[model samples]
Target: MKKTLFCAATAAMAIVSSPAMAQEAGDIQLKVVGTFVSPDGGIEEVVVDGVGLPAGTDTAANDNFVPTIAVEYFVSKNFSIETIAGTTQHDVDAVSGLPAGTEVVSNALLLPATFTAKAHFDLGGVKPYVGAGGAYFIWLRDSAGGGIVPLGATDADLSNELGFVLQAGVDIPVNDSGFGVTLDAKRYFIDTTLQVRAGDTLVLETDHKLDPWVLSAGVSYRF
Candidate 1:
């Protein structure tokens, strides 16, 4: 997935770099990108009731690739406000206590709503930016995996949590027009709580660390 995104970014850069206008205040840029979401998920603590859980239980979240869109408004020639829209899905597996790898949560979908304020720097023709932002990870859906369902676990839910993010990226102009290619990466400092239930009984409740690295590459049009 990383190789594919790198190749796409290379292609975009090669196709777009010609002559381009400079950014200015009151500019609006729209970007469409292919994003890679990689979450470093793990169990922080387990609250067990009416079930048996191993002492050293831990977890890992599967990576996902999805399409993303962003809108940025230049507040100044060197500063902008940006936000993105996208959804990513992941599956969690118990990495230590259950087995070598045992599925615990299947099809957990999330909407990561974010906003960032960035400082852009001009290096000859290429523009590089550093941003600081806030994020809210909203869990849209989730279900118990096969490994947990057999243990009478019926449903699972991840808590909606608010966190912060750090970002860095570069934008390369494609032409004298408002066309460009962009490559971006953001690191999210966040966490979530997972609760599993069976009928009317709360079977398992665990806290998880959800710091995810979100990488993106694609084209941008500014006007």
Candidate 2:
């Protein structure tokens, strides 16, 4: 009877300790995360007719929240490749000398797809990772305010951007199941061209930079 009890206890211990093992090579992880995006970095000056405008003459995009999905395929115990997809919308406001409470200069929709190569560190039941990759930004829709369209600016045209991405995150396994939680942050360096047009006549063209930081937290499942 004592030998049987010892065997049962050993089996229980193995079941409980299984999750502590690090993720092995050839594992696949999928995550559904909620993300909050905030635009950072200095705003560039808008130029008109060879004259630089005021420091705050550019438009500012508001912070936004969105849902994102990611898939990671591990090539080794410590190396993986991940891809993420998400879309966000932002309300643009004219800053600088613009009158107070006169916000809502325009609206912009952004669709970003990112691909990264990550290196994971195993520490007990927790896994921490850092990644670097590239991103492609599609400016789906950019519309100007009605009041500004007649001021020699009928429309706002934004070009698509290709940028670099930096990422860091941590994952905590829950129980011995393949379920976990993840917290992640990513920074994107994006630069694109903005064209102000009046009936096909280009009134102003300037380089616009939007370096945004995305923070996310959600559940993860490994297969």
Candidate 3:
């Protein structure tokens, strides 16, 4: 009877320690994420003709929604490299420092590409990760109106930006079919230059600091 009991215990241990219960090295994961970005920090003062504008001439960017896709290549059981792709649209407005009836609005389209190296921790069915990365932002077509437009502005342009990004996230595995759910957050440190023109004349040039925070949730699949 002791031999029978010992054999049963060993079988149970084998089942618990089976390779089917954990993720292994060389796994590839793909994720489809929905992201919301909120802008923070502040823009520099817009100066004109050697004179600076009022302190109230601050700019604020509207929150944006971005659909993102990412692919991760695991080099080891705990380390991976990931690349994310997405685009978003933001509207910029002069929120203060202007006349009571003055209005300012600018529409900007942005494309951001990012790559990160991550370390993941495995805890039973849950995995958590931390990453450090860099992002390259491409400024697409931008249009301005309201305060700056009426002041002889015919076009607006924003320079491309390169910045650092930090990320944290967790994944919860559902079932044994390699499907999971993920929650992620990232912060970006970015700065860009803005130029406004009126036909052949340059109207305004200024620097803007856009520190943005992104929150995301998504579905993931491992292959």
Scored by TM-score, the top model is: 1
lDDT of 3 by residue, 1-223 (tens): 2353345334433443322235677899999988888874256746452224566677777888779998999888889999988888876676667563343346688887788889999866567899999988888768765666767777878789899999988766665667777777788888777777778676677777787888777778887
lDDT for each residue of candidate 1 in 1-223, tens digit (9 for 90 to 100): 6686667666766665466687889999999998989998899888664668876879999999899999999999999999999999999998997885788899999999999999999874578899999999999898888888989999888999999999998888878888888889999999999899998789899999999999999889999
> What is candidate 2's local distance difference test score?
0.74
Q: List the residue pairs that clash in candidate 1.
A: 16-174, 19-175, 19-176, 20-175
Shift in Å, residue 65, candidate 1? 0.7
Off by over 4 Å in 2: 1-22, 47-56, 100-105
Identify the superior model by lDDT, candidate 1 or candidate 3. 1
How many residue pairs clash in model 3? 1
The TM-score measured for candidate 3 stands at: 0.84
Winner of 1 and 2 under TM-score: 1
**Clash count, predicted structure 1:** 4
RMSD of each: 1.9, 9.6, 10.4
State, as a TM-score between 0 and 1, how close model 2 is to the true structure. Answer: 0.83
Off by over 4 Å in 3: 1-21, 45-52, 99-105
Best by lDDT: 1
